[model samples]
Target: MRTYNIHEAKTHLSRLIEQALKGEGFLIAKAGKPLVKVTALGKPEASSTRRLGFMAGRMRVPDDFNRIGADEVRKLFEDDA
Candidate 1:
């Protein structure tokens, strides 16, 4: 854990970021007081690789899914007229 002043942090931002990405976190301070810590982030889950039917067997869709709520919705609006 190393502390860098504001000026040093600004001057070597890229290098600091690289170090953080390599798991070498550091602290940035201002006026000799610590302010923020830099660290690497965990890898993100990939959306493209996610399974689409993750709950396929856990749920079922009614055959009339789309039309199931049509009548009730239409009546609500009709009563407003």
Candidate 2:
């Protein structure tokens, strides 16, 4: 691991990112105090925006989904099992 001051980090940001993508991570600091880390993301960022409930109509729910195991679970919690 290597530490770079804020100015140096900004100047060499591109090269540092290349190194990070190659699995060599580093830190950026200000006034000798470490501030942030630079590392490779696990996957490429998605360009297309995603809307909430994208799978809303693609999945199914059972009729008993909300009531699954309600009886025995409640008994165990109340120490009455």
**Cα lDDT tens digits for candidate 1, 1-81:** 999999999999999999999999999999999999889988777865678987779998989999988999999989956
lDDT of each: 0.92, 0.92
Q: State the lDDT of candidate 2 residue by residue for 1-81, as single tens digits.
A: 899999999999999999999999999999999999999988745644566777888999999999999997888899943
Cα lDDT of candidate 1 equals 0.92
| Candidate 2 similarity to native, TM-score | 0.53
Rate residue 77 of model 2 by lDDT.
Answer: 94
Error of 2 at 29 (Å): 0.3
TM-score of each: 0.56, 0.53
Model 1: per-residue Cα lDDT at residue 41: 87
Query: Which residues of candidate 2, in runs, are more than 4 Å off?
Result: 44-81
